[model samples]
Target: MKYQVMHDSGPRLRVRAGQWAFTKEEGYGLASLLLDQDFIHDVFTSYRNGSILIYYDGEVENKQRIFDILDGITIDDLFEAEPTQTQVSKEITDDFYWNISGMIGRRLLGKWFLPMPIRNAITLYRAIKYIWNGLDSLTSFRVDVALLDGAAVTGALLQGQYDPASSMMFLLSISDELEHYTVQKAKSTLKDSLALNIDTVWLVDDDGEEKQVPAMDIDKGDRIKVRMGDVVPVDGKVVDGEGMVNEASMTGEPLAVHKTNGKTVHAGTVMEEGNIVVEVYSMNKETRLNKIIDLIENSEDLKAETQGKAERLADSIVPYSFLATALTYLITRNASKALSVLMVDFSCAIKLTTPLSVISAMREASDNRMMVKGGKFLEHYANADTIVFDKTGTLTNATPKVVDVIPMSRRYKRDEILRMAACIEEHFAHSIATSIVNQAAEEGLKHDEDHSEVEYIVAHGIVTEYDGKRAVIGSRHFLFDDEKIKLTKTQEKKIEKEATEHSVVYLAIDGKLEGLICIDDPVREEAKYVIEELKSLGIENVIMLTGDGESGAKAGAKSLGITQYRSQVLPEDKSRIVEELKAEGKTVIMVGDGINDSPALAAADVSVSMKHSSDIAREVADISLLSDDLYDLVTLRKLSVGMLDKINTNYRNILVFNGSLLVLGVMGLIQPATSSMLHNLSTMIFGAMSTKSVLSDRDISNDIEVEAIQVADAS
Candidate 1:
């Protein structure tokens, strides 16, 4: 682990351990290890130079900790090396540079050293492949870019112009290489942003007691518990228990795999049913399940609809280009002029630039803390006219506050009821549960483990065993209608009078009403402004749906300037409403953050999940905002719209510029070689332009800063 300081700045440091200090895999391992530190923001490591450059928090203690961690690295750490997404991107980039250099070297050396006959033979051999591809397209009854390219090269060869023919083929080869490199680089960039953040897991002790602990605290050989609806936190083998685990994240198959004792389970897969205790095999950088290239490959199938249309249009224009070439040859009786006309068709630029635009936009979205699954979702979001929002977590601030606690039964005190609720609720992700836990903490109430085997009923409530009683806490529907818990007239009246406007959580123990907790969810300060901005951006209908009472929903809608809303809606009702909106010919966008929101998410044209969304909701959503700010939604809208605009602009420019080229070529103002070279150069230029970001930093920030200042002043 001996190393020397190469460079040092306030927040950036470079250290080297000499050549061959670690292999390429170990460099990835070192980078992953450094990145896991809370103080480190980014890291770059090179095995050849044996250098690690670290970007980190500027605090004094953080700097010291980085050095200490580096000093402590052991040879054993290298054995557990695994490649990170950053490493994958670096590998692809290196390969691209090397391959491009090698291609150029071969082209130049072949030209300078090889005699005329050998060079001609090589050009003719390459021309045969292009000609065969054109024949294949003809056999399929489709004239495409391949046929046009083939015709251009064949004309040059027939005219005994081997140098021009070879040059054209070389340029085409370079274009194909560039396209492949762009696609692979885009996938690598996207894969880095899709990593799952598992903060905590249930660790099982040697005595078989299960306790929740941070995921980072566990290492190889630790046993952990995985339950229904929970994501497996590490790659491991099941020591005991059984479950149906969903391997969709690892394998694209939709079905869950049945895993029992001695069977293998992977990190990032979710347990759909049953429970299992897993013996940890690998953690962090060594986990095999992190290789998710298949998922990235699958995203190619989710191309934007506009991109598909552009590709089809490019092909459809190919036949017309052939007709133009034939007409020119018949009228002028000049083979060279006809060949020049054929060289300037409009497919290459159209096909290359559209996808590059989408991929670049996606990368920009990722840089702004948003994970977009595919380009089609961006197109859908851009075209969406109506948007539906869930009440608690979407419109209002998700941090609800506990206002009051009323005891229904004389046996339990208010503090006792509050403590009990927090004890069971701490494990759940609902806003109400967080409010109760925060309230208990503020009141200095310590809620230790007093419950056993808590069961979560999605959208309804929680059921658990508390103090030798069946304790149930949730919505009124869950306690009264579903569980058949009776509420006396007097108690009902007391609750109605006390919790008139606030949302109430009913708590029942041993089939008796024990207490009621009142929660008040305040509206987000920026909600009204975001709504106004969305309207300005062409979002016509803004609607809110909630499970709260009508009065609460009405007030929330009024405060947010939303004219349409639905109250007391169940999960199924939310889905039905979205479907009804679609039936009305509106492209709908649904925003939600709970397991109950999954159905509505699937029903909408495009769905977005908040930063703190549940696992199921994130799984169903097309886009997930990693930042907590609601304004990121506005940013997403602008990005999607900007992407569409760029695509259209590219299309228009391609048609006009290529058309001018065609006219000049047919007029005999340019040679066939010049026409071919100019056409390929334009395609490369358009592609390079498409990769530029759609929205500049100033474009995204200026409006946000102004609106935020205005909102603050008004408040």
Candidate 2:
């Protein structure tokens, strides 16, 4: 291979592969090879300039290793490489316009350039296929849009109006082409959104040294090192080190889970903090991400009620169209008048534009980092009157910070208390634990594992041994009631004063109260504004449900201007509340990001999971917000409402326009040919309009934050 370095910077390099890179095939091949390199983070190839850009995170000393690898590679290597799914999808989508243009050119040549007899014969042949489809519908006892189109063409041919009959068939062909194009474009956008591009990982060798290797080369029992912000490339168990691994991509829970020796991790999840060495249990098999892509590809069953109704209504109108044609013939004793009545049926435009509008809105929502599962959920979200939010991760920021540390034990200083807390806290993966450990690190408090084996009690706390004595850290109830740790009157009073308006984690040693860590969880910056926008958008009830104490929940609700909130609510109680609201005939939307909120997410009329939500919560949710911004919720609502409005507008416009065409044809003011042409032309026009974005510039700019607005525009 021959190349020249065009640009070089830390961790990034651009080079000209050769003159052959001017071809797309050569560029893609080079990109595919570079992307497979273990040290490379990303590869961008430009066929126009015969150049390739590579990003890597390896050591600076290993920079020359990249050039050495490329030196041994040749264009022949690219020919043997398998094409990625993303590349194939792009190729297919790009070819759509070429196919459409060819079809239109062939149709025009047949109609205007071919001899009259040959053109008429070809028109008759195409008309028979449509007529057969109509006959099949009739035999199946279904009246549909196909029947209406067949009747129009048949009437024109019987009256010896070859031009109108050929024109009608040609227009129907164009309508079919437009529908196919819309569907393919939507699928391509969705496929691109869900793709996972992890190709390499750092493998741990027998000597305990980490070496960069292609993910495909790793197998069972191999150890790999996953660092913060790196997507796990294989399903494995922790062998050494510890970290907070975010399994939201697999579990739908927004918070990262703690991974230590012997803990299991899955592929596609990211390490949010620290680093871990994992022993691979599985590699290169079906991943959770692939399942999500499958779900998106096979989401036809999730269509909205309006879409189904439009389809049914289109079928139902066919009989009425037949009767109208018969009535027109009886009144005028004219075939042309009867043909005119058949030419302007409303089924085509109504059925075609309805789903197009819904899909286009879904694509627009995806642009804003909101992945809606189906059109029905979008409709449900738009109509939801009441919204129930999980207070911990939904309304407040998921990241909590230590506000105060109250040391009660005379044997230990405050710094000693924090050092012991961080040692144990680092063993767990919760917001409280993260806050404690982070605070200790910021203060430069370091400690060896002075504790013995740590055991975690779900929803209670953690227990271990310090200096052969029992140690515990958890909630007030977990310490006082479960562990029976007694608190002195002075200590109780101190806790009441310091932890009254914040979340508190208790620490006890040898069955005696030692210290308390107070945590403050600030509300998200956009929470208040998004809440107000939801109300303005017609949400009638906004409520918060939390497992936090009354004071904490009340403060959060008040700060966000929410009037209704239920504190000390358990997980099941949250679902019960959602169900109770639904029992009252309220359409409820539940927003949450933890395992506790999974049941409620499933119980709601529509549910949204934040980007960091637990896997179970995400699986139960109808929509997933890809960013930690409440403004996306507002954007989603506006997009859903806009979709409904667009559908309604299409219906009204079709009715008025098509109805006028029918009347004019019946009065002999317009010929049957002109009526048919106008009818299909209008359907195509509305279909094209349906693909336009539902969100206006003003709506996006005014409601969404500047950074988010820019992301949407870039997408």
Per-model TM-score on C-alpha atoms: 0.84, 0.80
Worst lDDT 10-window in candidate 2: 79-88
Off by over 4 Å in 1: 1-81, 98-132, 135-142, 162-167, 193-223, 227-229, 234-275, 278-300, 407-429, 444-453, 464-470, 488-494, 509-514, 710-712
| Candidate 1, residue 402: how far the Cα is off, in Å | 1.3
lDDT assessment of candidate 1: 0.85
Candidate number achieving the greatest TM-score relative to the actual structure: 1
- Model 2 per-residue lDDT tens digits across residues 384-460: 99999898888888899999888897988898889999999897767879999999999999989999978765456
Report the lDDT of model 1 for residue 374.
Answer: 79
Local distance difference test, each candidate: 0.85, 0.81
How big is the RMSD of model 1? 4.7
Q: What are the clash counts of all predictions, listed in order?
A: 0, 12
Residue-level lDDT of model 1, residues 1-715, one tens digit each, is 8999988888999999988888887887788888889889888787877888899988889988998998899887774366656667877887788888999999999989999999999999989999999888878877899988888888889988887788888878888888898788777765664566788989999999999998878988999999877878789999998888766556644346889999999887777656899999997756765555355565656788988888898888898999999999999999988888888868888988888888888888988888887789999999999999998888887889999999998999999999999998998767899999999999999978888988877678899999889999998888999999999999989987888688888999999999999888998777787888899999999999998877777878898899999987888899899999999999999999876777788788999999988675676678988887788888889999999999999999999998988898889999888888888888888988998887778767845785667677889
